[model samples]
Target: MNDLETRQLRYFVAVAEELHFGRAAERLGMAQPPLSRAIRDLERQLGVVLLRRTTREVTLTPAGEVLLRDARTALDAISAAGRRARHAGEPTPRLRLALKPDIDGGLLPRILDAYAGQEAALPVDLVLGRFGEQAQAVRDGRADAALLLAPFDDHGLDSEPLVTEPFLIALAATDPLAARPSLRLADLAGLSLPDGSSADQGPASGWHDRAGAHDDAATASIAQDASDLPEIFRRVELGSVVCFFPASLTRRYPRPELAYRPVDDLAPATLAVAWPQTSRSTAVAAFVLAATTVAAATQPQKRETPQTAVT
Candidate 1:
């Protein structure tokens, strides 16, 4: 069997993501030639060509595609293992949770209280991340668990359903569509959706992408350039764009400038608690148990309210 080092996988992932040797090398703080040589060595050892290259561009071969996915998982596991080990040696270990800001809809305070009531509860650290970043936080060991929105890549994580709720469209109060009682996906045709660079794709892939193809408005989306939520809101206020959000947001962050309309065609949002698949931490286990117990008592039904968002 060919021996592959973690360093090799790291180099391969950098190159694969950048699709350019120079850019990948720059990102890794290494020279292009050494990075190139290392990838060649990796391919030789594995007995497969991972990348196809020409003068103009480099692309992944079939084997390369498989390796990229596996390599990401392996790299994440290694990183998480190291972080978890270091945390274990601390004077007083703590559990970190990650989640989006202001999306928890008033369930966080109670969950914290309940978890603290447990005999084995550890000090909980909150890691607030942008949307769709919860998965990465758990994978990287920055968090023991996360409150993540569904339709995210759960490849190396274990999750439990905490809350499920329908979606709503956020439009400027002054916009004509704001007066409508309810709207369907067809109503959004040809309108540009708000854009955000820091926003994770969340569940906007596969079926989501296909839905856009059926209507010009469905496919009309702004370029991925908005830096933050406030900026996206600014765009909405200007009547230039619109965005979809969980119904809970209407209660969590109601704005006089914004109007929320029920969207029947979009899939309901599912908030979940997710942890690294390989985690064996007692504190993490206890927290997950505490969270589930609290959720069952509170919601006890689908698409209900008072769901907490824990990170």
Candidate 2:
């Protein structure tokens, strides 16, 4: 059997992710013909049709989807290997922590301070990411670890629990639903949810993962996409879409037109720290320990059973 090369996997991943040959070729800084040829050759080598290429669009077949996920893991591992080698030669290396801004319930600064106070603590570099981008930051070797909302896809990552808090539904103040003191997932069944930043195209698997993890609730289709949080809020205020947010976010970004209601049925959103499975740095381990320690210490003493780490 012929083994696939890293270059081939890289090409396939690029094309699979973009689902557009021309754009993928542009991203790879290569001509379109060779890119197409490489994908064809890869398909022959694998003895499976990886993509369904039409004149109008490029879509992944089931096999192609599986390959894309596996290929991404392989590419991330290769990149991580190179990054670790480069960092090994550096005299003083820092740990990069990626997170979405303003979602940590003010626990970020405390965790950083606690970690910095630890012995042999490495300097921490903060990498702020847009919604649904933190996992990629760690996978692509840009971040050593990520603080993410949970029920996230943990395919190639190790995650530890940090905090758990109830969620709130964000809706327009003028909407009749806002008059309720609290609600459940079923309450917003048919109302569309703001998918994500327009850059991401739609409500990513992360949203679905969080929403559908342990529930039997009906989901809403993507009614709108916003480029940023403000745009999402404006859309909500305009009564076009709705969204679910961590309870902490409501305290941080209060708006006159935005009303938040306690969501009683959905599982509490769990904030977790995740690192790539390929990460073998002691610094990253130390940081994870520091974060878990601080998180555990901050929670009330009455809670005895600790949250298990997600492998």
Candidate 3:
């Protein structure tokens, strides 16, 4: 079979995502008949029935599902290449760094200052995203590097550990557990915690023991729904749900009604600077060096064992 063209992959992705030729064509700003014909041609060329079309609806076959996933990654890489090339062509290129705001373990300002002082450093642009988006932004070239927590999806990325801090549980001051000096993961088995399915929660937000045992029953008992930290804190303030966060958050977001207690048995959260494995930019290297330097100088005791790469 011939290699698939980018245009064909784009067309297939639109159709597969929408599962409707008319809608997909509309989305692609094209006519429906040509879109349908193109899909048919694609299927014929591949000799695979990618989609099952009934009178009422369309659904992807197993092969279609696989192609959809791979096609998205391919398209993202192509787009990233274009973006990087344009940035490189600029007369005064800048480095874009992605991170969640106020979630950098109190090291962002120092890192930025240190980077700015470097002779090779470029002007850094901040691309703030919600939790769990930093790695993706780095992977897709939206940013040159990202400050992200560990236990994240590290595929195709190289990361260096910056700071590691204990995880703490946030609870309402009125709650009985708030009075405890410290708590353990098993202590939260029956209490309501923030829903992990929410996108704005980080990878460390999941309620699991130090040995990595997931408490299914506790997860099932989670009743509060929160999208962001403020919402989670609001729920905690209302005694609706308890939440866990890295210890840095306590200093960044202290609340009168919420009490943050150490979770003795939970895994410590490690903040790392991650960049794409294929990156060869001097600015990125300089930024990483600055980040590590600042982290070590500012929080030497909190620095975890140096990690050369993540996955």
Could you say which candidate leads in lDDT?
Answer: 3
TM-score of 1: 0.84
- Relative to the true structure, candidate 1 has a C-alpha RMSD (angstroms) of 8.0
Instruction: List model 2 lDDT by residue over 35-84, tens digit each.
Output: 99999999998899999988889899999999998888888888877876
Off by over 4 Å in 1: 196-227, 300-311
Q: Candidate 2: global Cα-lDDT?
A: 0.77
State each model's CA lDDT, in order: 0.77, 0.77, 0.80
lDDT of 3 by residue, 1-311 (tens): 99999999999999998888887898799999999999899999999999999999999999999999889888878878988988889899999998877779989989989999988899999998766678888878888899988877787789999999987888899999888998877677667656543212322555321112223435434421233567778888998777777888788888899999987767788899999899998899999999999888766466579779878
C-alpha-based local distance difference test score of model 3: 0.80
Ranking by TM-score: 1, 2, 3
Candidate 3's TM-score:
0.74
Clashing pairs in 3: none
TM values, all candidates: 0.84, 0.78, 0.74
Candidate number that wins on TM-score, 1 or 2: 1
Q: Which candidate is the best by TM-score?
A: 1
